[model samples]
Target: MSSQPEQTMETQQQKKKKWEMPDTYVILFSVLLLAVIATYIVPSGSFDREMMDGVERVIPGTYSGVEGNATGFMDIFLALQEGMVQSAGLIFLVLFAGGAFEIVERSGAIKGGILRAVSKTRGKEFWLIATVSVLFALGGAVGAVANSVIPFVAIGVIIARALKLDAIVAVAITFGATFAGFNVGFLNPYTVGIAQSIADIPLFSGMLLRVIAFVVIVSVTILYTWIYAKRVLRDPSKSLVGVLDESQASKEDLRAPFTARHKFILSFVGLSLLFFIFATIQFKWTINHMAAFFIIIGLVSGVIAGMNYNKVAITFLEGCQKLVYGALIIGVARAILIVMENAKILDTAVNALSVPLEGLSPVFAALGMFVANGLLNFLVPSGSGQAMIAMPILTPLADMVGITRQVAVQAYQFGDGFTNSIFPTSGPLMASLAVAGVPWIKWAKWMLPLLLIWVVIAVIMLTIGVLINWGPV
Candidate 1:
């Protein structure tokens, strides 16, 4: 009879497990449902918009109460279809660009090249950490934050094991550095470009500030990583992974010697990035242009790596398969806006958000935007999706609060980019952690401090943006 207590405890544990948090899709769709419900309770309103210089600008002080067109049951599902159709261009961009990169990865050039780099810096462990961190950071800067990034994360963990560092250190170099680069977002199209386009600023208008932030964030990230490495090196217990695994580098990693093909592919990627910047700035390349360029890159990269047309086609499809979820996320998130728009409550939500910020000074107002966006990201985690939902309101709110549109965009990027490192809801981050065999609890404990420090840096950067009236360049 005494065993009855243990049986009851087991039953209780299973019950608890049943109530655990839902997946990201459930959470997003729940939000969508709630928004549908909210349309009934929240008063409808809107602001006047006019086209100026081929861009739509929301006029401030134009918000007024209007009749609510509450969404019906049928309208809910219809919103999903409309959302996908509306965001089709962006969704295809994710697929084509993703597939192109997948082809590049399949060519074996990138992995072989990075492995060779790691081999050359065998004795200087800290330099390896710094260099690899920079490489990963550069990857994020170039819009490489997807499932395919797992190979790189795995590489970082292997390097960490060889150097007697912990998994957190591995993540610090990989995810941390990538986030630093991504948050600054100098040339990252996925986040920065969408944010800029939504804000109706010239594409990549605030390049100089982004360049400065990138250098500062990446350098700080490297120093922080090196500091942690020193701790782990001096005492293995300093590792959050319990204790460091004192193992040597895997010989398998270094088997592929760097070849001329790898060199050529790397050079092509570099020049392509440079040309992308020049083209966007000088020739005004849009998403279509970027998508076409990526397809060209994939095709050329495959040919150079000696892959046949059939192999290239297969590899490209495989890559597109990887990003299918992200593309759908963009659509589902657009559904949130679609339903709100259909119900005539999107502008109402915007008015509610803008009213309070209007009372604060520009700096505090900008800071408030940063915090609000950060908090909202916990629920709406996708970057492109968040842009769709938030920017319509923020663009005009920036005008109402005497803040620059560039500052608003900066706030959105800062708020959006940093959370991906710490949040469990992020698929790429969670997958990276799984590849490295690190637990979420440990990662959160170690990463919390760096995220806080990044927040401080972000606040300073945003304040500067406000002080200088950081307008589009």
Candidate 2:
């Protein structure tokens, strides 16, 4: 009897431990704590910055030691305030986009359109994956489509179920494809544009190479996703989330027919996105403009869907409420950067990393930069923010080492974009997983194989980039 009781107690303890993964907030704050410790250990430094054509450009060879301002425990809370202030535009963008998408979703337009697409692609699931993934890739390549795709996770999951596939396949097809296109982006203004501007290179200068990369990477992603999707489709029990699959099955098919109203709503969103891109390129629109655009689109979309103003208000608030976690995550993630900036060790860390590249050959230099940027992405997940911090240091280092600034940008693109799909600190990735009801640990497991394959491909691309002297040096 004593042994039986001990065995039962041991089993319960094991079960409790099995389900334990640190909460997202805990992980982020823990990183904050480490940043505090780093302030004491790492030297403080900075680069001389100047305004060139209205953008702050870091002058090369200007790094120097600065007085250390190590953060105390009390400063951590103040850093949170600074982080929110810095990330306010991004936070509002998330809120507005979430609200607008919610309005469109309430119109049954997205669901109706998705159902129709699924019906048309029935029995040719591979093609469905290809088509959906490509469209998503195009959006990510040309526009700010990462957060935009969050609303589509439900639609993708629905398609997965209708086709007898699993939620992992749904996430891979949607988030995975977007990430591939983003990393290999031919014209991603958020990453490529910002990096190029910071590097003082002509915007979108090395297009052909990036276009080729985008095609190759996205093709590989589609193929990889389709293979796993096929396996799960063949035997549902083979799914990583097999137990959850059963619960997902009984979800009601709420898909309606794509009506004229739905078409109008989608067209409005599509046109608004086109305007966003044009304004961004021609008029230098920022995140604030994007946020306002989303708010306008939400209100207009609600009116177009024949909703009363009160209903629209309620729906928009509800949508924002749903994504509060995601929006807060943007600010919280920024807190890490705040801590680093205040400590003045960000430049010191960059300088230390760059020291080894001084003697590296061109190809090795490019690869080293790529690896460094990937590691840095863990600290600063925001594309524009990472560009601001890293490109300043890496650009000068690239020229010193015979690597083109364009190649430096390419390395940053690959490093910054690909990691978002896997990193726990990625607000959008974590939010999408939560929306899909997949655990972060489970997503990590399913994503590791693909991540490894992409890393290999990234190495090859960086090698080719260096070999050809991918330029505008």
Q: Which residue ranges in model 2 land beyond 4 Å of their true spot? A: 1-19, 50-54, 135-171, 182-212, 227-255, 373-413, 419-453, 460-473
Model 2 lDDT, residue 361, Cα? 82
Kindly report which residue stretches of model 1 are placed more than 4 angstroms away from their true locations once superposed: 1-17, 247-249
**Reference-based TM-score, model 2:** 0.75
Best by lDDT: 1
lDDT of 1 by residue, 255-278 (tens): 675689888987887798789888
lDDT of 2 by residue, 357-421 (tens): 76788899998888888988886676656765577668767755777788899899888988899
The TM-score obtained by model 1 is 0.93
Q: Please, what is the whole-model Cα lDDT of each candidate in the order they appear? A: 0.81, 0.77
Superposition error at 438 for model 2 (Å): 8.7
Inter-residue clash pairs, candidate 2: none
Give lDDT for model 2: 0.77
lDDT of 1: 0.81
